[model samples]
Target: MATRPIRMFGDPVLRTRAQEVTEFDAALEHLIDDMLETMDEAGGVGLAANQVGVTKRVFVYDCSHIEEGLRGHIVNPVWEAIGEETQIDQEGCLSIPGVQKDTERFQTVKVSGQDKDGNPVSMVASGLMARCIQHETDHLDGILFLKRLSPELRKEAMAELRNAEWNQEPRG
Candidate 1:
């Protein structure tokens, strides 16, 4: 597996909704491996297909470190909240590069999707793991965490965003 280039925030592809994967073929499996490598290299908990310039409803995540031994991928995934929305947490994205912002998300979530082998799987996640899932899945739908930010905060972040460097190598 090799790390794939991540599409930056301003890329038009990042704003376009991803297409669902209909055929679980070799190429799809390859993409999943590449995505896992990419996410690992970038030190991200989750990554979406759109973030890698593939417009597909595919995302990979490994929250095992967060929840201890619970980790996997989500291809053509769909998610729903388990309860009422919860407080805001500061979230960051690999697509947005160095930028980070606060956003509100459900504290618990139930997601359904296929595994790398195309086997159907469903699981519930909560806390930071849940937030990460929501954030990454949103990217597949062309949604950014900044979209969930407060108007005032978003306005303030714009200036910083303008000055932010998108192509900078991740800090060690």
Candidate 2:
């Protein structure tokens, strides 16, 4: 597996809703592997296919600080907020480097989807794991964490993005 270049803010792929993963094959497996590798390389807790410039509904997370350390690849996932309790926490994204924002998210989440082989997969996550799942899932929906912030915060985030020197060199 290889680490793929992360698509930054302003990239059209990051703004488009990713398509569902249909073919459960070696290619999908390889893509998942590469995503995990890319996540680790970028020091991100989770990543979605859209972040890597692939318009597919797939994501991987490695939030190892939780109970048993949630780590997995989810494809074509659907999630729901489990409780009314909300948590406001600092969040960052691999696509939007050098920017962090305080975002409100569900304190607990239940996500269901498919594994790389298309088998059913599900998880009930809380704490950081829950936040990570929500964040990554938002990417699949073409919603950046910046959009979750207030208008003023979002404006600040956009300014930061515009000023930062994103690594825009073409990736082979």
Number of the top-ranking candidate, with lDDT as the measure: 2
Model 1 C-alpha lDDT per residue in residues 1-172, reported as the tens digit of each score: 8889998868899899998888898899999999999999999888999999999888888788867866567888899999896868788888776667778899999999887678998988898888977988889899988888889878866666777876445879
How far in Å is the alpha carbon of 54 misplaced in model 2? 0.9
Cα-based TM-score, every candidate = 0.92, 0.93
Residue clash pairs of candidate 1: none
48-164 per-residue lDDT for model 2 (tens digits): 999988999999999875565578889998999997999998888988889898888999999999999999999988889899889988899999999899898889888888778
TM-score of 2: 0.93
RMSD of each: 3.6, 2.9
Measured by TM-score, the strongest candidate is 2
Where model 1 places Cα greater than 4 Å from the true spot, the runs are 167-172
Task: Name the lDDT value of residue 96 in candidate 2.
Answer: 86
Q: Which runs of model 2 end up more than 4 angstroms from their true locations?
A: 167-172
